[model samples]
Target: MSLAVTFAAIPYRRTGVVEMSDVGQVILCTLLLLAIAVAALVVLKRKGWLARWLGGSAILDQAPAIKRIAQTRLSRSTVVHLIEVTGRRMVVVESKSHIRMLPQDDMESHDPNL
Candidate 1:
């Protein structure tokens, strides 16, 4: 019996190395830097370094109830009306200004007059 030897061709993949544009490289580098910065910030926050550095607690503390009450004591619309009627608004703004009336429904709950 005679054995025949056969040679099989192997396919090789050629990788094309493409050069990136200057702008694309800059953007990519910037994004990588930003990612690194964000990662560092997250690490600092996790270790409570950020809070200590800022002179605050790591956990978000609720604002004092009295402070909230004081902040929301007067509504913006109400204060605006008071200012307009009392003529303090013009003095405060330091100019002759025409007050544009906003629709009541458009006003935000936390809108400030001053």
Candidate 2:
């Protein structure tokens, strides 16, 4: 039996400096501005001034439109059954042609009798 040893050569290359186009610079600037705007908005939101200017209660009420649609659509197609185990844990079974399990920890917690 003969044993052979093989050696591989490593490859390296020098990289040239990159020159960005006007569009690339504009995009980078736009992204920076967007980040700053988001930070400002977050600060304003934390201070409650954003809510005051935007009519926060109205916005919150309107935010449920999509959720209401989803719930209505799902309820029409799926049959929902609830089972309470104890304390703040409940199992919600949604069955259509198939059975699906859902945990209702928050729901049970909010229930007055729970």
TM-score of each: 0.33, 0.32
Give the lDDT of residue 6 in candidate 1.
Answer: 81
| 28 Cα displacement, candidate 1 (Å) | 0.4
Query: Cα deviation in Å at residue 66, candidate 1?
Result: 16
Counting only residues 3 or more apart in sequence or on different chains, how many pairs clash (N, Cα, C under 3 Å) in candidate 2? Answer: 0
Q: List pairs with backbone clashes in candidate 1.
A: none
The prediction achieving the highest TM-score against the true structure is 1
Off by over 4 Å in 2: 1-20, 57-114
Candidate 1 TM-score, true structure as reference = 0.33
Candidate with maximal lDDT: 2
Report lDDT (CA) for all predictions: 0.52, 0.61
Candidate 2 TM-score, true structure as reference: 0.32
lDDT of 1 by residue, 22-54 (tens): 668878899999999999999999998898789
